[model samples]
Target: MDEPRRNLVRWLLGGGLSASLISFLYPAFKFMNPPDVPEASVNEVSAGKVQDLKPNTGKIVKFGSLPVLLVRTTETEWRAFSAVCTHLNCTVQYKESSHQMWCACHNGLYNLNGQVVSGPPPHPLEAYSVHIRGDEVVISRRA
Candidate 1:
């Protein structure tokens, strides 16, 4: 080919290779150094009304950016805990059949008080404070 045509071919090939290389490296670069994102600073959250949750049942409530497990153990009793498992940060759920909090991620069990009962969890779940304000149920981080 003529010199001009060869130069044009070389430019096109170089441009394509650079684009492909950038496409592959961009994601890895982003994965290695993620952008800083500020988390929501929330101290308290209203889960819902007292009547919304029935006794012997549990529900997951969002407290800021984290999940909070709200359980009504008895007709007049309430409990709130950080739903994250201490072992692997998995979301925990209330197991009514056994009257305990359970992390299915590794079969970790915790009592209603958030103490690690058994399994791979190295620490107890973080306990939160529950308050009854009129007919509403409010959950707050413990000091």
Candidate 2:
């Protein structure tokens, strides 16, 4: 083969191999350390209607990626708290019988106001202010 022709083929092969490696590695690197997705700024969350939650009952509402527990302590009183367990990041639920938030994963207890009552929880659940807009229940982060 001519010298020029040999050099051209070598250059093309190297370029092709480099492109192939980059194509395979780019996705792997992305998967390992994925880019951060911009979170939607959520100042408040609508839990549900007043009738949807009976007295002394609890419901879970999505506040961004995490869950928020909404509890109706009385006929007119409503409360909201972060549903993620402080101990292990487990989702918590409202136990009507216990009348408080309970994390079944580690037996963590949080009061209606989000204070840690017992178990392995290190801190209290994040509390959100509750407001009643007619029939709808509104929950917002405290100032």
Give the 10-residue window scoring lowest on summed lDDT in candidate 1: 34-43
Model 1: number of backbone collisions: 0
Q: Give candidate 2 misplaced runs (Cα > 4 Å).
A: 1-31
Q: lDDT (0-100) at residue 122 of candidate 2?
A: 98
Off by over 4 Å in 1: 1-31
Q: Write the per-residue lDDT of candidate 1 for residues 1-143, one digit (tens) a residue.
A: 59999999999999999999999999999999978999979999999999999999999999998999999999899999999999999999999999999999999999998998999999988899999999999999899
Cα lDDT of candidate 2 equals: 0.90
| Each prediction's number of clashing residue pairs | 0, 0
lDDT of 2 by residue, 1-143 (tens): 69999999999999999999999999999899967999998988888788998999888899888788888999999888888898999999998998989999999998887899999999999888999999999999889
In order, the Cα lDDT scores of the candidates are 0.95, 0.90
- TM-score, candidate 2, is 0.77
